[model samples]
Target: MLRPEIARSWWRSEMSGLSPEAPNLRVEPDAVDRRSRLAAAAEPVLAELAEQLGDDGFCVLFTDRESRIVDMPIGAGQLRDRLEGLGVVAGGVFLEETTGTNSIATAHELRRGVAVHGEEHYLEPFKRFSCYGHPIIHPVTRRLVGVLDITCDTGNDSPLLAPLIARAARDIEERLLQSTRRAEQRMLAAFQAAAAGRSRPVLVLGEGVVLANPSAVELLDPVDHIRLRELAVGIVHRGIGSPPPHTVRSVELASGREVSVRFQAVAPGAEGVLFEFDKPDGTGATARIVGSARRPGVRTTEPVPGMPVYVGGEPGTGRTRTVQSLVDGGRTRIVTLEASEVAVHGETAWLADLESTADDQPALLVVEDVQLLPDTCAVRLRRLIERPGLWIALTGAPLAELTGQGAALAAACPAHIDLPTLRERTEELPELVRAMLDSLGAGDRLRFTPAALAALAGHPWPGNLSELNAVVRAVAGHRSVGDITPWDLPEGYRISPRRRSMTPLERAEHDAIAAALRECGGNKLHAAKRLGISRTTLYNRMRTLQITT
Candidate 1:
C-alpha cells in the first residue's frame, strides 16, 4: 500500500502534469554547481556508505533539494545501467514534479526516512528498483538540505537500507552543525572580551543576543530584542533618515535613572549596544552626536551659475551634503523639490517660482528622490532644463533602473554620479570616523583599536554612509572613552573562533579513518576490517573526525 504522504505527493505531481510513463534523464549543470559545498563535504561520508554496501547490490545516490542527482556510486554495473536508463544518474531530476513520486524525492518531501518498493513508486520506470532515502537535514537550522538514497533491484531490498541512509544523513547533519558551534563559540568569546571592564550593559546582536559582563541579560524582554533589531536596521539600512526619539533617546531604567545606549556595528545587520546609566563622567555637550563629516573630498571651485547639476544617490548618502559644499561660497538662490512630495501630490510645488525666475540669475534646484518624479513632472522639468544660469541636481535609484520610464528625466539632468555603499569605502571609514569624532569634540578623548577598525571594515554596509555615520555617532555618545577594541564593537564583529589543535593520537586517528574510508569505497564494514577495529569503533572514530554516517 502506498503511504498517505506519497499518495498525496503523487497526486500533486499528477496535478502538475507529470506523466508516470515518461521519465527524462536530463541533468541540470547549474544544480550540481550550486550544491558543490554539500557534495564536497559529503564525499567521504558517501564513499563510506557505498563501501558498506560494496557487495550488497545497493547503489548510493545523493541529490539536492531540487531532486537533481548530484552524486551517485552504484554496486552492480547492469543494475546501474538499468537505473541510469530510467534517469537515475547524476544531473537527473527526480522530484515529484519532474519524475513523479519516488523514494529520493518522496523522502525529501516527507523530510524523513522512507523505503519505497515496486508498486509504491508513482512512476512505472522507478518500480524496477526498491529505494530507501533520507533527507539530509541541516542540524542547526533543522531544514532539509538534500536527500541520501540507497537503490537496489526489487529482489535485493532490505530493511536495513532505511536505517543506513538515515544514519548517513545524520552524519552529514553533524558535520554541518560543527560549523555552527564553532561560529557560536567565537561570538561568545568575542562578547566576553568586549564586555570585560565595562560597567554598562553590553548587548550583542546576532541571530540572537549575547550579553557581556555587567549587563543583566534577564532584564531584556523578548520584545526588546525585536525592537532593538528594528531600530538598528531602520537607522542605518532601512532608508529611515533618523531613529525615533524614543528609540535612541535615553531610556529610564527601573532604578529611577536614565540610561543612554550606543549602538555599534556587529556585522552589518547586527549591532552591539553599550548602555550608560547616570555615569559621573557623562558630559556630552553636543545634542546630536557627530556622524561622518567630509573634509571636502572634492575640491570646490566657484559654481558657474546656470550649469546643470545632477546629484543622485540613496537616502542619507552624502549627495545633499556634497551639493551644499558646491554652493557654500556663493549666493545661489537654492530651491529644493522633494520628488516624493511631487509624486504624491501629482505636481511640482516649485514650478511656479521656477518659472518666474529670470534666465540669467544664479540658482540651484535640488531634486531629492528624483526616481519618483512623475511622467508629467518630467515634462515640466524638461522645459526648465535648458534655462540659462540654472543648475539642477538629482538623487535616486540607479540610472539603469530609471532607464525604462525616467530616461527622459535623467537626460534632462546630465551630470550623474553613483555613490558607492559603505562596504566599498572601507579605507575611508577610519579617517571619516576619526574626523567626525574630532568635530564632535571626542577626538582627544577616544581612539578605536585595530581590532575595532578591522571589524568595522569587514561589515557589508547595506545602509551605506548613513549607517556608518549613525555608528560613529553612537560610539561617541555612549562608548567609554578609550581605545575601542573589538569587544567595544558589536559581538558579531568580534567573532573569531580560536583554531583547535589536534593531539598526535587524534591526528593519527583522523588520517587513518580518512584513508580507510577512501580505500573501502566508504564501506564502513570493510573500512573497520581494514583498520582492524570493530565497526562500532570505526563509527566512533569517524564521528571524532566528523566523517561518520
Candidate 2:
C-alpha cells in the first residue's frame, strides 16, 4: 500500500515536475519566519497548519501582485539565510523565467499548483528547499489576487505534503466563494428593506426590475419600474431601427457620480436579464409613482368579508388605492408583492411573484397583474390555495387570450367583482369628482360647473379612475374657484360625440368576461360567480364572444 506521504510526494513529482531525489529533511528557521508574518489576518489558518504539519515541517508564504514575497511564517536559521540568498526575500519578486526552480513562480504563471524539490531550483542556494504553492483568488470577484505557498528543506520533503497543501488551498477557495455569496445576499436584503414602505420608481426589464431603489427612482423621471424597463427596451429597439448618431444609452448614478450604463446579455436560459448601471451620486432624489387617468366608468373599491375578493379593471382604475384601503381598514394585512421583482430563496422555498409568501398566518397576498405571474408561480399558488389561512388577490388589464393558464385561474377563485368604468357609470361623475376634490382639500369651494362635469363624464376615460383624479386635481390647482367649465379640462380629456357608438351585446359580453377575469384574480370560477352564471355558461359566453380560453 502507498503511504499517504509517499503518494502525495509522487503525485507532486509527477504533476509539478519536482524530482523524487530531493533531500528529505526539515528546516525550522524558514517555517517560524513564515508563521510570524502570517500571524495577523491569517494567524488561525497558519496555526492550524502548524499543528497538523509539525514544527519545521511546513511554512506559509504570501505573495503580492508581482509575485513578490510579501509575508511568510518561517523561522530564522541557517537554511533561511540560504533561502534568502536564493532571492526569496520580502521584496524579491518571482516569475517563471526569473525563478526557474521556485513553485511560487511556476504556480503564479500557470494559474495552478506547483512543487519544486531539491536540485530543481535554478539557483544553487534554493536547491536546499522544496516549495509547494497555489494561486489565491479574490473571495467576491473570483479574480486571481495573490498566492499562498508552503516551503520546507529538501531533507524534510515528504510525498504527502503536496496533497496537504493542495487540500488547504481548495478549502480556502471554497470559503472565499461562500463569503462572496453571503455578502451579495446581505446587500440585496438591505436594498429590499430600504425599498419597503416607500414608493420608489421602478423599471422592470424582463424578469426583474433594473432600477427599483429609491435613489434610482428619484433621479429618473416618474415612471413605473415596469414602464422604465419597457422604455429601456424601446430605446434599444429604436436604436436598432434608426441607428441614431448618439446611441441610445442608459445612465446610472453611482457613488455620487453619473455614469453611462452597460449591459451584457446573460444566457438565454438565465432567470433574468442582467443590467449594470453607471455609478451615481451618493445623494438620491425622492421617488414617486407616476399614474395615468382612469378609463370611463371604472369603479374602485376595497374587498369586504365572506371570501377573499379581487377587483379588476383597466389601468389607473384605482386598484392600488382599493388594496391600500383594505390594508388601512384592518380588513387584511396586505403584502403587495410585485411579480417583476426577483427574489432568491433556497431552492425548496423559491417562488415566483404570485407564489411568494409561505406564511400560514392570516394575511392577504396581493399580486399585481395576475397575467404576468410566471407559470411556476401560478402552479405554486394553486397548491397554496388548497390550504387555508391566507387570501390571494390580484389585478390585471384585459388579456387578449385566456387559454391553459387563463382557464386554470378562472377555476380557482370563488368571488370576483368588476369595477364599472367612468363612461359606463357617468351618473356617478359628480360624486366621484366631488370626492376627489375634497380629498385634494379643494372641497366644494373648488367646484366644477355642470358643463365641465358633463364634459369630463362624456370623455372615454382610457385611464379610468386615475385619469379622473388627475383631471380634478389639475383643475383645482389651475382653475379659479366657481369658474370651472368644460374648457377647463385638459385637451386629452375632451369628449367627441362622433366617437360615441353603442357596442354590440357580444362585444359587451366579451368586455364583461375580460373584466370579470381580471376582478376574479384570473380565476374562471370566481369570474362566473361575479357574472351570476355557471362555469359552463361563462365558458359558452366566452366562446360566443370569440374570447380564447
Candidate 3:
C-alpha cells in the first residue's frame, strides 16, 4: 500500500501554487456535505456496481467522512462477511495509516482512487483482499466528499477495477448535481408564480427580494412595494419564523387566501427566504372577463366614438361585461344583435345595421354570432361598414368558413381582437372573482375557500369567462356564509367528460389561436401581425378554421 504521507504529498501537489484570490479557488463546505449525503443515498448506483463486480468476486461499499461503512451493495453478502471477519464493521472507520490498506488510506490521502492488490496490504488479515477505491466529489462544486470502494478476493484483482470504480463515483456525482439543479429550477418557478399575480403573493427576503419582474412589486403593501429594502425588512420581520436561522412557522389565512413562505439555503453562506400571498377572493373578475372577450372580429381599440364593440369567446367567457365596460353606459345609440335567430331583411334593410342619418349621429353596431348571418346578409352587412359614419363590431365562435365575410369587413376596417380562453387566463381568475363579487355588492363579505380557488384554477373553462361568472353568481346566491367552497360550484363545472369527436388537428388549431391571442392580449390586429397576415386575411382564416372571435 502507498504510504499515507506520500498520498498527502500528492494531494498537496494537486493544489500547488493556487492563489487565494483566484476565482476558481473557492471552496464550498455545503457542496461537500451534500455530495456525502448523495453518496449515502445512492442505492441504485451501488446495486449497479455490485452487478458489474460481483461475478469477479468484488463487492462495493460507500463510506462516510470518518470512514465508517454506510452502505454496501445487496449481492456483496459473502464479501461483507469476509470483511467483517477481517475487522471491518459498520461503525469502524477504515483509513490507510490505521488499516495499512491501499483502498481506504490511498483514497483519503490522495483525494482520489487507489488500488492495493494481494500482498500490498501491510496488515496480514487484509492480504487476501484486493481492493480498488476512489473519492467521490460534489458534481457542482467539484469538492471531494466521499469514497467508494470495491473489494474482492486476492485472486480476482485485475487492471480494470481501478478505473471502473472511479467512473462509477463520477456518475453518482453527476446525478447529484442534476437533482440539485432541478430542485432549484422548481423553486425559482414557484417564486416567479408568486411574483406574478398568478400565484399566492410571495416576498423573497434574500438580496432584497430580487424584484426582477414587474409583478414582484405587487406582493408588497402599496406604499412599501416600491422600496425593495423596506419590503425585504417587512418580510423578514412578519414572516412566520422565530428569527433568521431557526425560524419556522405557518399560518392559515381566511378562506380564499393563498400564501407560501419559505426559507431556503442555496449555499453555506448564501441563503434566501420567500413570502407569497394570493389575492383576496374576487379581485380578478375584470381581467378574466377581458381575457374571454377576445373574438375574431372584436375590436380592442375603439377607432371611432359610439361604435358597437363585439366580443366572442367560449360559452362562459365574459363577452357582455367587457362590451359594457367599453361603452361605459354612454348614450352612443347602442344596437345589440344576437345570431341566435336571423331575420331575412331587404338588401336596403341591411343598411339599418349601419348608423342612421336621422340625426347624422354615429352609432355603435354590435353584432353577435356574425357567423349565423346568411351569405347575402353578410355581404350586405359588409357593404354597410363602408359608410364613413358607422362603427361595427362583430363577435362569434370559430368561423373559419366566414373568411370571405371577414375579408369583406377587413376591407372596410382592418382592426380586430381575439380573446383568450379561461385556462389561458387562469392567473386572473381570483382577481376576476373579486371584481364580480364587488360589483354584485358583496365586496366586503365575499370570499372563496382554498378548494374553490383550486377547482377554478384546475378547470378548463370551456365556456370561458361567462361560465366562470355564472358559477360565481350561483355560488354567491346559494351560499349563506361568506365562503364559497368547491362543493358549492355548479354540478359538472369542474369535470370535463371524454368526448370522442374532437380531432387532434382541431385541438391544435384552437390551442394555437388561444396562445396567440394570449400573447397579443386578444388584439386581432396584433395577432394578425404575428401570423404574418393582414387583418382581412386573418378574419378569412378564422372563418375557414371555424374559429369564433
Question: In order, what lDDT does every prediction score?
Answer: 0.61, 0.54, 0.55
Candidate 2 — which residues are off by over 4 angstroms? 1-306, 324-328, 342-356, 360-362, 398-401, 496-549
lDDT of 2 by residue, 1-549 (tens): 544433443343333222333321112233222322122334455567767866565567767545667666554356566666555667555654234446777677667777777666544556678888887765544456567788888878887877877776666666655544544444354345545565533222332123346545454432122222433442322222332222235442211233444432222221122233443544442222112123233333324543455556667766677555455366666677655442344323446324436463447776666655567766776676556667766665433334565436535756554555555555456657778888988785776654466466446577778888888888888865775755688876554221122354654676778788877665665777888997657755654444432
- What TM-score does each of the candidates earn? 0.41, 0.34, 0.39
**lDDT of candidate model 2 versus the reference:** 0.54
lDDT of 1 by residue, 1-549 (tens): 567877887776664345678753346665464324456557778778767777667788888866778877555777777877777767777766567677787886678888888887777878778888888876754657789888888998889878888888888777766655654665566567656786555666543334544444534332244334544553322222444222345543322234566664432222233332233233442222122233323222223445555555555667777676556565657767676776455474545544554243446777677667667766777767776556776567655567633667666665555554455445456667777788788998888754466566555456777777777777777785886766666554453211122455875676678777778666655777888897556644654445432
Ranking of models by TM-score: 1, 3, 2
> Residue 41 lDDT in model 2?
30
Error of 2 at 298 (Å): 8.6
Q: What is the total number of backbone clashes in candidate 2?
A: 64
Q: Could you tell which candidate, 1 or 3, scores higher by TM-score?
A: 1
Question: Which stretches of candidate 1 lie above 4 Å from their native place?
Answer: 1-18, 27-81, 90-98, 107-111, 117-120, 136-146, 152-160, 168-306, 311-334, 338-363, 368-391, 394-549
- Candidate 2 lowest-lDDT run of ten: 264-273
